[model samples]
Target: MKTYDSISAYIEACPAEHRTLLEQLRAIIQKNVPTAQETISYGIPTFKLRGNLIHFGLAKKHIGLYPGAAAVEAFKEALGAYKTSKGAIQLPLEEELPIGLIEDILRFSVAAQTKSA
Candidate 1:
């Protein structure tokens, strides 16, 4: 599989009407966590700061944002409407993804990582 070094490279490769939205979300995550490392894992874009913090990807129906186990547990109520696994939360493209909620999740992920270490 092709891997991208920077989030821009990933954005440039995305093809769809939602490309802009995905890129915008990526930028928001990067902006809020400037020190995070960008990488592609499990065919998804992931950010690591101090430890693995989050992962996101585009799907045919929605965007998959994995904000770690802690975030998934904390946001269970808000995320209950979507399909989810142990470590991922599916945010449909039809719905306006909650940017503030994602940021808070990132913050929580950072703290979780620190606590575990």
Candidate 2:
């Protein structure tokens, strides 16, 4: 995969149908973590605040949200039908984005990062 220097470039490389969703996701991230340092990490769009706060990007079948293991564990019960791993959540392309759940996760991430710092 090609490396991206900016989030816009990464989003641009995604399928045209996914761009709006990716942009919405980016807006949510910015709204929730206004102080975060946006950058590309692990070849994906990432937000940093002392450490890596979260990483998100488009995928073949879903948009991957890497909020690390802690967030995944904290929100596991609320995850319901979404696919999750140790540190990642896969939001399928076919479904509408869960705006409320996403906001909660983003807030939780910011709180954790703040407490740690």
Best by lDDT: 2
lDDT of 1 by residue, 32-74 (tens): 8888898877767888887678888887888889886768889
Please tell me which predicted candidate would have the highest TM-score against the true structure: 2
Report the lDDT tens digits of candidate 2 across residue range 1-117: 799999999999888999999999899889888899999999999989889999998888999999999999999999978999999999998888898999999889888877987
lDDT of model 2, residue 96: 81
What is the Å distance of residue 112 in model 2 from its true position?
A: 1.0
Q: How many residue pairs collide in each prediction?
A: 0, 0
Q: Give the TM-score of candidate 1.
A: 0.87
